[model samples]
Target: MERTYSVLVFGNEENDIMLILKFTDQKFQSLSDFLNSEVHNFYTHIQKELEAVVTGQKEESDFGGNMLNIDIGKEETEVYYQMDDESLGEPCFISTDELYKLVLEWKEMEEKMRRGEDIFPVILED
Candidate 1:
């Protein structure tokens, strides 16, 4: 028997990507340890990107109430929101309309990842 984790990169149904990391007890522990150490930094970057897109700012900021990373024992996962409303400044705003826009943006991002492009260090232009 073996245990594995599935990494699903959610974009649009048209082009969804996933990575499956299968590791032995030893390797899983090793990888898990490493990811846990880097989870915070990874989350920070996600938060920064969210801020940039939502606020139209080039600089990064703390992720006030966004759920960027989730830690599960020896594994971590990433989640993105279409609107960081708190940062975007309007708690009363309902942004269901933004879902389609985010889908397209995420689709493009997924394509880049398919090309083995570096996830961070690249900012999208408006």
Candidate 2:
């Protein structure tokens, strides 16, 4: 199956734009005001961890905490996301190859935004 990832812009007012990330059936959202904030850090951290897994620094590892947890494996990676405070949502598995590409795409989008490039409604399918 081809997995789809999208970045969408929302909100009614110019000052209220929100960034929405759609990954298959899941949606993660953030205020545009914080577009260059903590979320980027999380993505970068995950990217590094994924790289470590790819480079054989560790047999397996995990990234994220609290609302999200990614179990990184050699071939497959499990992504778990939760919006609620007390429970975790169902886990989804994607190939580590695809996850690496997705994270790189996200980091590229962030860089574009930082450079004042328009990146709304971006779609990545793999």
Candidate 3:
């Protein structure tokens, strides 16, 4: 089955920080599964690079050299990324620390949801 996903980047350039939130297609078995897998993939990739930097095998500056590339289904996926010109850096340049924080926040939200907590507030439609 084909699945869709969304990658949202939220932050300001003045602070040079961005938070990335990836939502898995609801068509999947469970949100937990999807989130777990996605987080695992990200962790694996980042861990490798982090280890390299720790071991002096790679330069710290090269850690987040590549742009954030997420694969989404053609018809089902949607992406939202916006940045003000005043922001100092591009979305592609989000730091590893920010990415790590995003993952942590994602996991925390998932846990809260599992406990039957509502993470999103109700929105009134016009």
Q: Which 10 successive residues of model 2 have the least lDDT summed? A: 27-36
Per-residue alpha-carbon lDDT of model 2 for 37-123, expressed as tens digits? 334557667778888988888789986654566788999987665454323335567777766776776667656644546656566
The residue ranges of model 1 lying beyond 4 angstroms of the native Cα positions read 1-94, 121-126
Top-TM-score candidate index: 2
**Pairs clashing within candidate 2:** none
Give per-residue CA lDDT, model 3, range 1-126, as digits (tens).
222222223464433322233334332232223234545356556445434544556545222213233222212221112223323222232234433444455555544444545434322111
- For candidate 1, the 10 contiguous residues with the lowest summed lDDT are 69-78
Every candidate's lDDT: 0.36, 0.57, 0.36
Give per-model TM-scores.
0.24, 0.65, 0.32
Candidate 3 wrong stretches, greater than 4 Å: 1-37, 40-91, 122-126
Given candidate 2, what's the lDDT at residue 7?
A: 41
Tens-place lDDT per residue, model 1, 1-126, is 143333456897644655333334442342332222333234344434444544545332222223232221111122233355444222211132232233334445445656766553343322
State model 3's lDDT: 0.36
Q: How many residue pairs clash in each candidate?
A: 0, 0, 2
